[model samples]
Target: MTVWILVTAALGAALSWLSCRFLVLPLLRRRGVMDRPSERSSHEVPVVRGGGLAVLSGFLPAAVLGMLGYGLASGEYGLRSLVTFDAPGFSVLAMGIAFGFIGLVDDLDSLSASTRLLAQVGVGIIFAAGVMLLLGVGFFAGAVIAVSVVYVVNAVNFMDGLNTLITGWTLVCALWFTLLGALTGSGSIAIAAVALALAAAAFLPFNTNPAQAFLGDVGSYAIGGATVALAWMSWAFGMPVVAVLAPFVVPAYDVLRTLIVRMYLGENIFQAHKSHLYQRMHQAGLSHETVARIHAGAALVCILASVPAVLTQGWAGELVAVSIWLLVLVFYSYGPRFVKEHRAKEHGSSSNNAGGRA
Candidate 1:
């Protein structure tokens, strides 16, 4: 069964790569939906954007395949069982695809913030309602979940600026969820985890630093929605909130600090700026890969540290996760300053050396 899952994942990745390389990217380029470099941009050249549609191509089919396989093995109608209320599973899958469409629409026209927020809220409510109806949760719990979904979706969208940052970070989170699923004996969670991991893997090649393509709004929104959905599933399946949220702690901290700082500076929080900690590292002469690696490494740390919590579901686990989260906040606040100063000193040293030689 594991081998089949692995094969399915590999196939999904391959299909995603092919779809992006041959279909989505080419179409976007032909339509001139490229990301041009600007004062607030990270890349130097225009790249075909909206490559995240390829991830959808990979993830959605694999998820359907997983559903079918599970259903047929049990002598049930494959897709029929999935869409029914026996499980809240279909809602997870559908919400991801729905948000992707919303994002694609916005990418095409750059919708107003209020419009996008309303759309996200509506989707969140629908997802919460589905979960509540399927799992028999009360309205209060459902409302909380709905609010969390909105927060995560927007958080992910905000952190999608750098190449391979969100893509790779999301992959790490998905894999952690897969591990958690395996440990907890939750097949649905594991299936979702693998699908997302493989899809992100397929998208990573084109989206790395010096990327050939960007995720655009479509990729970011879809990835965000799917991730939050997966985390919610993990929590619903009995993992502690700390364990479920640990994978995202780094990104959450970074984004929160950025927002607070922006507000403190009297800047419009909605306005675009190259002031993120990761962006600062990029401006300090770190390559895109370096900055992305830094963030990814932080994500990996959070995942590893949170593992015990997922496994034990105890105060110890929660404490460790929270501690790591606090540390990540400190890093997010000061890491960029350290990198910037180091880069400045390095530049000064190089100048002094050149002067001495000349």
Candidate 2:
């Protein structure tokens, strides 16, 4: 079963890569629908934006096969086992696609903030209501899923300003989730994580610093959806520590911190800007590659550390892992000041900006 799941996920990731290299990427390039830099952009040249369509290739098929398998094996339509079509999970996927489409429209042409907000709300309702119905999770959970999903998706989109930041983090999360699934004996979790991780790895060749391609809005929302869905399912089945931190610690921390800082300055939380801790690192003189490496390194470290935490099957390792990651979050937020400042060294900041993200 493990071998089969891994093979299936590998196929999905490989297919997604091909879609990017051949269909999705070429279509974007030919249409000249590329990401161009401005004050909001961290990159220099016009690169393809809908690169995340590649993720859909991996995610969508995995959802179908996995869900069908679960339904057959468990004798229940456990769609949550696959793509999480159940309420909260369904809503998460829906909202992610919604926000992603908004980003996609923004990529094609400017969209009003209201329009984007509406779509996000629509998706949020689905996710929130689903959790309420199925898991009986609560007002706090509803709010958390709704707000966290939007912010994380947006933050992920924000992080996409660089080369592989989104992809790199996503890759790390996926690998960690896969191992967590393996240790805990959850096939769907392992399948989903490995598939997405492989997809990230496949794209890393094109997305590394001085990246040839950008994931755009499509990719950001997609990654956000997958991250939330995986976390939800992992927790629903058991109290695994990896399931908890995978969504909240790495991605959620940055979003919450950024929102607080922006609100403190009386800025609209929804507006786009380049002031994220990672962005600040870029502004303060760290190259996109260096900043990306540091964060990706953190993610990799989390993966390594999480192994024992999951294998241990208790809260002890998880608690330690969470503390370490939380401490790193503090550093991620406030650490740049200690580094020697370098001024915005990259002129065409866009290209070099494309480092590790998601």
> Per-residue lDDT of 218-263 in model 2, one digit per residue for the tens?
7887787677666666666664756456434655666667778899
lDDT (10s digit) by residue, model 1, range 231-344: 877777788888788877877777777889999999987777887788887787777877888898888887777877876879998898888877876776677788889988
lDDT of each: 0.79, 0.68
Measured on C-alpha atoms, candidate 2 has an lDDT of: 0.68
- For model 1, the local distance difference test gives 0.79
| Highest TM-score scorer | 1
Off by more than 4 A, model 1: 74-78, 85-89, 355-358
- Per-model TM-score, in order, reads 0.93, 0.81
TM-score attained by model 2:
0.81
**Which ranges in model 2 have alpha carbons more than 4 Å from their true place?**
66-102, 241-243, 266-272, 302-319, 341-358
Candidate 2, poorest ten consecutive residues by summed lDDT? 86-95
Per-residue lDDT value at 30 in model 2: 86
